[model samples]
Target: MVWKPDWVASKDILRRMGWSVVETTMMNSNPPEIEVPLGNFVKMNILFWNCRGALNVDFKRRIFEMVINHHPSIMVITETRVGGDRAARIIEDLPFDGSIVTETIGYAGSLWLLWKTDDVDVMLLSSFEQEIHATVKVHNSDPIWLISTIYARPRLSERRILWDSLKAVAQLHNLPWLMLGDFNEVLSSEDKFGGNQVSLNRTLQFKECSDVCNMLDLGFTGSKYTWTNRRPIFDLILERIDRYFANPSWRILFPEAAMTHLPRTCSNHCPILVELLGSTPPGPNKPFCFHTMWLLHPGFPNIVQEAWTEDGDLQGAILEFVSKAKHWNYNVFGNLFAKKKRVLARINGAQKSLASRPSEFLLTLEKQLIEEYFFNFTPGRGILGTEVKIECSYVWRP
Candidate 1:
């Protein structure tokens, strides 16, 4: 239980403000003494991949690469195309300590939910041919959430069954629910390229199901397309069928949760890594520096006005305003630094895609992101820095 002087002061302040603090054990500490809010202190990584087939000779190596790089507490591999003793043997050699397997239907959809028992407790709730639902409780944490790993069947008729099953599961409990996998269906035309346009009729069922379940798409960080058909330039087909969706409850639980589309290797579908960072170590405390961007928020004036008191204690009023303004900036206007990081990530992903394929859509997206970065981060600068333009690629200088 390492306690800093500042943390001690914070604990006293929180207790005085009627906030409950608990000495919960975190993954980083052996016998935890850190006092945090009375809730889950989760900070774990999850990796989901549609491995297409897991029987290849180098499959174990690929899994090792992902595990070594991401160190995920939970991992889901869909479309294994293997079952029975063969599947068990494959999982046996993997890095995780616990595992659950949903056998394939004659070389079709299968799901392997693997987890580190040392880091998390996963209770198998339901397992179907196309999906595996589990209650995940991070070790030494009070939060318990439901996680569903799905692999919707390739055919439209079969996918309807998957959607219906999910709806039924969604009704079981109102816990923070997270569903992720290869849906084998696109939600919009923007989710695909070099293929027949995705018609509304094709997307209507999935959209309806999502709306009924109140699911929000947890946007990804890397290339928009997650799967590709390995073909020549003229016939190449790409689609972002694999994704993560969470209910509003789950989003509120982990607002900083983000998913990254990893580079495609050993499979057509790119691996998606989801990060839930809840118990990260606090940074150094610095004097408050007012941000110019807060002026852009419509609610800033209201927050200042509310913080101002009728009493003639100028020091107290200034302190109150600072506290209220910081809270508003966080909960309403959002953390500008975090937003800037996401924007830069999107820009990097777009630039990478353009470097490989040079698509008009990606080029335009990169240009827009560049303008946003310059306008928000650079003081006294125009949106495009200085006359930004896109020829075959984006050209900008600050």
Candidate 2:
């Protein structure tokens, strides 16, 4: 497909908004790779989404925004619907620089990769004698081999083919390997949701596959199943087919890695978000802070107090006080700079109103402002609120 000017503009806008857009490249060519300086730590996040069909333009745009917002380093997509010439064009449109491997027919394909940075290399290995597989190498770290989506038919023979394909990749890579995506085979009775009986033969086959590959199953603890067949027939419904298995080496590389289910949109299977760490210092966890006490100074108290007496606006008086407390530079605080400026602007406006207010009222307003600011800056008990104070150099996509 021809690259439209509008599409290029849109892609640029998306990148500015923090989406990694793929550059144009020849079909079937490896994504470009650049040497990443050796670092103490490197963190990479990979997002896996099936995309259902992605044929709808609106849905495709939403997917683009979602990836941009999350800002993963590498994205593995399954079930990409673009076919033949359209497939090449779709890959061209992706915000990241990467490659695509689609099924003979558009929507049935197992896997595709969209890589953002030049620090990583990708090699598409032989298509599974019956499945899909690829090898990815990250500069300055051990290589990671990936196997794509695997679908199993109801017949045991077909499931055997899927298992055999997995073993083949494990044997070929010989290094750290991560086999993820839809496995289509439930490993145990616990893997399914209620009312469905898992087949003993299927469970045995899955265990055998794991044993032969020397894999560790990262099972779902919260959600019992990954797939749901609405049919009433017991034989027709099976679940928990989507999973990630890795060898000890890969496990050490990502000790905290686990699957998180994304909200179900157009697809029956939920997308998985995976985080990989390579000796990288964890990024800052706490939101930026602007100290209110820093704004209160002996010399500035009189000016702010005078403004409070003239302007009755309490928030404005506090902002006026903070503006004069210039010792606290917003630029030093990184993410908190914008918020500080906004608060300062609002306070300046309030100072005019406070200039007419009584001294007592102004004092109370200042105290209240300090209290509110402190409360807002306090760390809370949650993922976003947790404080991360570690100091280390690391490279991350975000």
Best by lDDT: 1
Best candidate per TM-score, number?
1
> RMSD for each model, in Å, please?
19.6, 18.4
**Cα lDDT of model 1 by residue, 92-185, tens digit:** 9988889999988987778999999999998876688888887788887776677989999988888999888887655444567899999999
Question: What C-alpha lDDT do the candidate models reach, one value each?
Answer: 0.73, 0.51
- Give stretches of model 1 more than 4 Å off: 1-39, 278-351, 354-398
Give Cα distance to truth, residue 381, candidate 2, Å: 34
lDDT of 2 by residue, 340-387 (tens): 335433433332233233244543453455344334433331111112
**TM-scores for all candidates?**
0.63, 0.55
